[model samples]
Target: MPNHPQPLRSDYKYLQPITTRWHDNDLYGHVNNVTYYSYFDSAVNTYLIEQGGLDIHDGNVVGFVVSSACDYFASIAFPDRIEIGLRVGKLGNSSVQYELAVFKDGVEEACAAGRFVHVFVDRASNRPVSIPEPLRSALARLQA
Candidate 1:
């Protein structure tokens, strides 16, 4: 498999720092494949809460993951601080595609990169809804 390309820190408008746990590693001594997705989730959600004012608990609109993809270029181990980069790719009426790149501290290259798509839906009805104004504004700032 080919590794994901790394984007420069200046290229991304938002970033979130993540700590890798011991269990995040697989028997092969590198971070497990699944853990990267968790980091992507955290990074994106954190940005939404801080920048988009997303209310995960009581918000009328919620995002559901409809698709995800990742490409690993290097190995990252436990105790490393992973700096996750985020940018908005496609902002649809009810969905947003977030691109993420994970770097092992200070590294200019990404150890892994991928995308996560969230479809906004009404919390009560579970039906698709347009992106709220506040959220849309926040997301637009991160457009790549």
Candidate 2:
């Protein structure tokens, strides 16, 4: 593995707790690799909805994830309580690059770290649009 920077809990601005379900584990007795992405997605959307006032159902603008990548450092299994740390690494006219890390609750070192990029777009037209003010303001607080 390349020497990617391993993220610590303190590196993130927002932390969201998530409970691991039994189904999250695969035949290997650990959380499947794909499940980590779901956690990342949930954490980001939760922040956008609760803090950024993103209206996923009826809003004129919606964010569509354009890119994502993850690096795993350790294993996690079902019944483990986890927290996902989130921060904005880059903010653009119509897109935001969110940096996130998954940690076993209360642990400092991240088990997995990832980046997710969302491009805000018109729901009907499906064309990119400038991020709305409310969402931008919310994202500002998460800058790292």
CA RMSD (A), model 2:
0.7
Number of the top candidate by TM-score?
2
Distance from true location, Cα of 56 in model 2, Å: 0.6
Report lDDT (CA) for all predictions: 0.90, 0.94
In terms of lDDT, which candidate is strongest?
2
Q: Which residue pairs does candidate 2 place in steric collision?
A: none
At residue 134, give the lDDT of candidate 1.
94
lDDT of 2 by residue, 67-139 (tens): 9999989899989999999999999999999999999988999999999899999999999999999999999
Clashing pairs in 1: none
Compared with the true structure, model 2 gives a TM-score of 0.98
TM-score of each: 0.95, 0.98
Off by over 4 Å in 2: none
Q: Write the per-residue lDDT of candidate 1 for residues 14-102, one digit (tens) a residue.
A: 88999999999999998999989999999989989888999999999999999999988889999898899999999999999999988
